[model samples]
Target chain A: MIFKIAWRNIWRSKLRSFTVMGSVIIGVWSLSFMLAFFAGFIEAYVSSAIENDLSHIQLHHPDFKKDKEVQYRLKDIEAIEKQVTSLDAVKAYTVRSLNNGMLATATGSRGVQIRGVLPEKEAAITNLDQKITTGVYFDATQKRNPILVSKRLAEKLNLSLKSKVVLTFQQANGALTSAAFKIIGLYQTGNAIFENLNVYIRQEDLSRLMGETAMIHELALLLNKKDAIEATQHYLSQHNDSTQVLVENYQQISPDVNLYESQMSVATYIMIVIIMLALIFGIINTMLMAVLERTRELGMLMAVGMNRSKVFLMIILETILLGVIAAPIGLVLGFLTNAYFGSYGIDLSSYSEGMEKFGLSDVVYTHMQTADYLLIMIAVAITAILGALYPAFKAIRLKPVEAIRKI
Target chain B: MKEVIKVQAIKKTYNAESIPVHALRGVDLSIQQGEFTALVGPSGSGKTTLLNIIGGLDAATEGSVLIDQQNISQLTDSQLIDFRKEHIGFVFQAYNLIPVLTAKENVEFVMLLQGKSQAERDARVKDLLGAVGLSEQIDRRPNQLSGGQQQRVAVARALASKPKFVLADEPTANLDSKSTADLLDIMAKLNREENITFLFSTHDQRVIDRAQRIVTLEDGAIISDEQNAIGS
Candidate 1:
């Protein structure tokens, strides 16, 4: 009966009820979209890190990680690759010999990490072949040394496709070595930090030039299922000769990616709290007015035998019903907006230059977890209950004799 | 007959700090079961104050009000509300039917508070609304009804809970002559047929003339209490 009365009472002032409900609808919609937008940004950043340089997991000579010396190479690269590849969790793997080198053109020279990679394996792991913007990824027909340089690096060095550059570095015997390589491909990974430092070359050519027949400094692994990354990393760490090799996951390899990943949920909660706090004041104001306008009616209700608790419950129920009615409309609005933007993505090309500085794509696809949607609904419900308390208390505090005369 | 309402030297003072205005001054009154009585007085004579104290709507400053042998003054605020719900029904001068509810729903509201079953509430609402000559107006909200019709709905609501008595304060003050007569006839019939007690505070001569007993007040004190051999 109290529910029936309360339900009917809200309609007595239809415009006021609609106004409060409309605010709730707008609040929920904007909060959801905002959370989704931030989630997309974080997703783009983390995945770009994984795709560009940080594979799901990596292995290196324990000494090579501290000092990039060419002598600290994996002893039996073939055996380690064989063991890791047999595991079903290992989707693809690449072996790389890294050296700190300087790339000098007729214009200038800059320090870079010259990565020695097998073209086919590197393509599968980093998708480097697909990111080429100017030329083919490491042409097999060429007799000269072919290399891949990021578009940003190429532009900095004033080099283009088919341009010749000399890479100067130390050999395995600590002798100075220099090899001239042609830029076969110019690629852009949308990562300013990676673009500024790293360049790719064929492992065979680098090994021959450094006077070593077989050299491997790093092993990068991609997983079939990302959720199994921890299990695979644990397995690889235990299976390998722990005294020589160190296994590190993507997060360990790049701490910035880890920070971006963990902060997504925290950012969502902060957004919800901010939006709900604003909504709380609006709801409190609306409910307070509702209670004040019905002072006489509420007193008569109490005088006719409705207890204080019932009156309090009636007021709370009215506020909750407003949220209950508005939430679905907001959720649907948010869902439709996310759905449309999730598939096609929101174009941010006009700001691509700024976005690339943070390794974010120009087109961001909004993504939200199921748990976040549920959490938002629960948050709105709790917010509605909190907003009702002061107004409900004011309603139950009315003295019947005085309130009845309030006309 | 058992005494349904008893008051002994009940005193009510408002704003007792700077200047005390006594609304009820040592007033003693009693009414037995099944009595249709009127509390009549001129303006500022404390008839409404006495009615409020007896109805448990306001507390007396010095003395206690006992209803059906229970000392209402001794009850806590929550207990007093429950007591009023169980033992007293109110008909306000403004016909304060819950504006959101229809006439039928207004009458059923008290029974809902009592936690009565659906069948009992339905039966009593039909009987009371029919008895008040508002059977045709049951589906109409208070705002849709005339002032007299709204008061009739209030009357039906008052009796729906089958309380010990009905307390009406100027129930007919906003009514025309015909409406007042019609309302008086309904109260008289309900009292005669069902033995329901009624107590009203009024300045209307028509209401005073129809009461079986009349208690008149002067200067916050009851001056006369009389039983009439003839009443409308």
Candidate 2:
């Protein structure tokens, strides 16, 4: 009955109730939308890096991860492959040799990152084979040098299907070596960083270029669960004798990962502070006014045998009611805001040059996440109830007889 | 006769702007159960202040008020609330019913606060509202009711707690002659029929004339303590 009375009191002055509710709704919506954007964007970024660029984990010589220069190569690849593939967590593995080389065809020549990989095994680990256009992917069962390169790289080399290209690089022994490979296919991967220079050939061709039979510079492993990369990596590193496991997907391992995470963390904290301040002030003002107006009412309640603490509880319940009324609406508004902006995106056409000056990406869009809405809704509910507590306490502490006399 | 209220030399002082305002000056009074007593005085004679002290709304500066021999001044604030809930009923001149509540709700609020079961509150509120001639107006808010109707609801609220005594602080002051007469008749009848004690502080002639005993005050001091040998 007390709850009913308090609930009805809010509607008795509908404007006051709505004003407080509106503030909470707006605060919750904006805060949730921002959190959603951060979470969603980070998810997208990691997926892009993992699937598009780096595999989930890599196995190489102990010094290879530290130096990253192509000095480390495994001579006995079959032994390492058998042990790694036996693990249930390893979805697939690819042998890759990252080499610095110059590509030449009739039309042009450019320095490129020449990746020597087993086409079938690389297909399972990396998205490169799936990106191949214009011709078939390289068949590992076939003869010598069958290479795949990006459309941009192939275009720069002026190579078509079955067109021959020369790749020149220095071997591990510091001897200059050159090879000719048929351009069986071309790929147009969207990343400009790799698209301009990325080229692929068979591992055998790379071994011959390095003048070391069956040598691999890097062994990259893919996993079904990206989150379990650390566990899988730890197990692989401890169990393996010759190979050192570098535990990272490209997305997880990026140098910019901390920068992005910290940026997101700071943004979330600021947004919460701004939102909670506004909401707290909003609820506190409403409840204070409610307290002042209900002075005599509260006193009357005390006169009727209500404990002062119970009176406070009743008022706090009213604030909780306000939060309840507003939170679902706020969640919907947040979702709508995120969906609208996430899809259509906020165009920075006017500030493109300004953004370029800062070197940030082109557009700003608010993507959605469940965690975002959850955090804001919880905060909204808590803040609303908390904001009412002091005023409620004040109202309940009033002297019943004095209050009755004053009115 | 059951001793309903015994006030012993109650004193109350207020400090307004650093000046001591003595509102009650050692007023001692008592009334039996089922007695209708009127406490009358002009404005600022501390008539209302005396009523507030007895109502457990204000703490007496010195001395004690014993209702049913329970020392009210000694009770904590919460205990005082419980005392008010269990033993005291208050009717205010402004007809101080909760304005947002319906006539029935205002009456039922007392029992609700007392932690009375729903059936009990419902039964008492309905009976009391009917007794105050407000059964039909039970659904209306204070604004929707006339001044007379609002005061009737306040009376019903007082009675709903079934306290040993009902204290009216000029409960009929804002009423017209007809409503005032009607309210006094109901209270007077309830006193006789239910053995419920009634006390009032009023200059209103109807209330004083209706009283079985009259205690008069002037300048925070009681001047006349007279009981009509022949009752109204």
Candidate 3:
């Protein structure tokens, strides 16, 4: 009966009730959308980092991390490759010979990290062949040594496809060696910093120039399932000789990526708290007005033997009913909006330059965990209950004698 | 007849900390079971204040009120509410039925507060609404009913809980002569048939004329208390 009265009482002022519901609906919808947008933004940035630079896992000679010298190249490459290929979780793997060198063209010279990679293996792991905006990816038919420079790097060097560039670096014997390579292709990744610093070349050409046959410094592995990353890293870490080879996951390799990923949950919770706080105030204002306007009726109720607790409960029930009705509508609207945007994506092309500088993609597809949705629903329910307290307290505090006489 | 209400030397002063305005001055009154009584006076005569005190809606500045021999003045605010719920019924001048509720729901509300079973509430609502000649308007909300009909519903609601007595503050003040007469007739019939006690605070001669006992007040003091053989 209290429920019946409370339900009917909210409808007494239909406009006011709808106003409160509208605010709740809008708050929930915007909060959900904002959280998903942030998640998508972070997902785009982290995935770009992983896909273009850091694979799911990496293995390197332990000393290579301390110094990028050519002498720190991996020992027993065949044995390491055997262990990596045995894991079903590894979808693809590649080995690279890394060197810090200076690339010089007719116009200028700049520092660059020359990555010597097996063309097909590197292409399989990082999808490197697809990033080519011009020319071919490490063509075998080219007579001279072939190299891939980023489009940004090509512009900075004032060079284009088939242009001759000189790479100078230290050999395994600490001898200064210089090699001339023709740029076969120009690739563009979302990361401006990465594009500016790194260039790729064939492993055989690089190993031959470095005065060694198999000069593998780093082994990168891409996993089929993201959820399997930790377990795969654990298995590899347990199997490998840690003192010789350092095994690290993408997060362990890139601290900023890990930081961004962890902050996503914190940012999501902060968004929910901020939105729910606004809703609490909205609900408090509406319920307070409802209580104030019904002073005489509340007095009459108390005078007729309705207890203070029952009166308080009725006001709370009314507020909760408003949330209960509006939250699902908002959730559905949010879900549909996310579904549409998730599939089609929200194009941030207008801000692409700024986003790309931070390694983020222009088009972001919204994504949220099922747990986040449930958390938001619980947050709104708690907000409703919190919003009802002050108004309910005001209601229960009314002396029936004075309230009844209130004109 | 057994006494249903006993008010002994009850006094009420408003704004006591500043300029005190005494609304009730040591008034003593009692109503027997099955009696129809009126507390009558002009404005500021303290009739409503006296009725408020007797109804447990307000505390006395001095003295005590015993409803069915329970000293309500000694009861805490929360206890007073429970005591009122079990022992008292009120009908306000504005026909204070819950506007959101239908005629039947208005009468059934008090019974619900009492935690009466649905079958018990339904039976009593039907009986009481029928008694007040509102059987046909059972589904109509308060706004849909006329002033007379609304007051009749109020009367039915006041008796829904079967209180020891009913306190009405000008129940007929807003009604036409015909509605007033119809309301008085229903009250008189309930009093005679079911032995329900009624106390009213009013300035209306019609209500004063129908009371079996009239307690008139002036300047917060009872000036006259008399029983009229002419009224039943």
Candidate 4:
């Protein structure tokens, strides 16, 4: 009977009911789109940062991180590889000597961070070879002094394939050294900053050039599970001793990506609050009008022995039912919106540059969240119930005889 | 005869600007079960005020109303609602029916408040609609029905809960003479056939002529209390 009465009461004033629901739908739609896009943008940043900038984790000689010199290499290279590979969690690790070297071309010359890498292992950590826009990757076992540079670096050097580039750096024995390499390939992963600064060379050739045998500065490890990145790092940090360890992650090495994630979280919460506020006012106004329109009916209910509390609760239940019906629809709309945007990403280039000023990537994408949808459902339901309070109180506390008389 | 309503020195006052406006000045009255009583006077004559005080809708300033031996004034808000729900029914002049409810649903409203079962609600609501001669208009909303039909629905609603007493305050004020007489006749039949008490506060001449018992008030006090008709 309460349900039947409440159902009829909703339709008693169609315009008012429609207004309330319309506001909710709009609020849900707006928040869904905003939060989803922000989520997408942040996820894109984290994945891209991890894939290109940092793998799961990187291991360095404790002092090597400070000075970044080949002389600070760990004593046993093969043993560290064996232990890390046996962990079951470790997918692959690339041993590389990463330090500054001077490169000279016919067009120009500049100092750059020259990375010495094994071709196969290096490919998994950095996608630079895969991003080759011209020529090809250097062969790992070919015993050739060939190197790959970014398109931005190539542009700076004004050089093409087969261009002989000279790289010079101090050796582990404190000896000045230089190596001439044939320019094998040029790559561009769309990041102009990285493309302009980095050069890749053969690991064996650079090891001989550094005057060190079977030694590298750091090992960058890649793992399959992303959530286990910290755990993997922790495992290595705990297992390894004797050699000082420097554990670096993209999260710390590049804090911008993490900052982006944090900002998106705050934005998502703000959107929820804004949307809920709109729903709050809408629902409150709706129930107020409902009580006014149904004054005589409520009084009649009270006169018939329905107490004030029951009157209040019944109305709250009505609004809760209203929210319950609308919640799934709102959630589906949000989920579908995220799915749609996830498949076909929005072109935010024009918007991106402006947003980049504030350190936010403008590539608007959908970051779908299961928990967020649930929270939205619970929030909307709460808002609807809260909105019913005033009217419910009025209905139960009214002087039945006088209220009916007024009607 | 058992007394359905016993108003013992019931005084009602309205607080306006914190000063009391005496609405019912020491009202003392009694109506027996199965009796039709008329409280007749002009506007502000304390007729409706005295009726409200007895219906447990408003608390008396001083005194008590014992309906079916229950002191209505002393009951808490919830207790008063329960008391009214089980023992009293009411009819108003305009908008007597819930606008959203059909004629049957409006009658069912009272029965629902009485916690009647579905089967009981359905059977009794149908019978009440027939009793009010609105069987065909049971499914129609109040706006779709004529004033006469709506008033009949209101009367059916009041009687649906099967209360010991009913307070009708200007129930026919908005009705034409035909509808007014129809409503009066239905009340009269329900009073006689069901052995329920019917009390009306009205200034309508038609209502006055039909009442077997009449009580007249001047200002906030009753000036005459008499039974003009001998027919029971």
Measured by TM-score, the strongest candidate is 3
* Tens digits of per-residue lDDT for model 1, B51-157: 88888889999998889889999987788888888899899999988988999999999898999999999899999989999899899999999998999999989
Docking band of candidate 4:
medium
How do the residues B1-232 of candidate 3 rate in per-residue lDDT, one tens digit apiece?
A: 7988899998899999999999988999888998999888899999889888998898899999988888889999999888888889899998888999999999999898899999999999999999999999999999999999999999999999989999999998899999999999999999999989999999899888889999999999999999977776
Question: Per-residue CA lDDT of candidate 3, range A1-407, in tens?
Answer: 89999999889999999999999899889988898889989998888998999999999988888888888877889998999889999999999999999999989999999999998999998999999999998767767688899998898778999899999998878898998998988999888989999999888988899898899999999999999999988887888788888999999899999999999989988889899999999999999999999999999999999999999999999999999999999988888889899999999999998988888889999987778789889999999999999999999999998898886
CAPRI accuracy category, model 3: high
Candidate 1 local distance difference test against the native: 0.90
Query: Residue by residue across A43-71, what tens digits does model 1's lDDT show?
Result: 88888898899999999988887899999
Give the CAPRI rating of model 2.
Answer: medium
Worst 10 residues of 1 chain A by lDDT: A136-145
DockQ of each: 0.83, 0.60, 0.88, 0.69
The estimated TM-scores of all candidates read 0.97, 0.84, 0.99, 0.90
> Model 4 over residues A1-407: C-alpha lDDT tens digits?
67777777776677777777667766676677777777777777677666665677877788876686767887677877877888777777788877687899877789888888888888877766688889998764445798888876887778888889999887888787988999888876655555566798878888888877766777877787877788777777777783566676667667777777778878888888877887888888888878887777778778767778778878997787677666776667878878888888877888764544443445666877788777777778778877888878877777888787764
Evaluated on chain B only, what is the TM-score of candidate 3? Answer: 0.98
- The residue-level lDDT of candidate 1 at A331 comes to 82
Instruction: Give the fraction of native contacts in model 1.
Output: 0.77
Which tens-of-lDDT digit does each residue in A1-407 have in candidate 2? 77878788889789999998888787778777778766656655445556656677776676766665566765566877887778888788888887887888777788888888777887877767678877878874667788888776666556788898898987888777888888888885555565676788887788777977666777888887877787887776666664444444454456565466568768887888788978888888889998888787787778767788789888999899989999899889888888887887767668754543332334557776577667777777778777998898789778887676665
Candidate 1 clashes between residue pairs 3 or more apart in a chain or in different chains: none
For candidate 1, the docking band is high
lDDT of 4 by residue, B77-107 (tens): 8888887777788887774677767888888
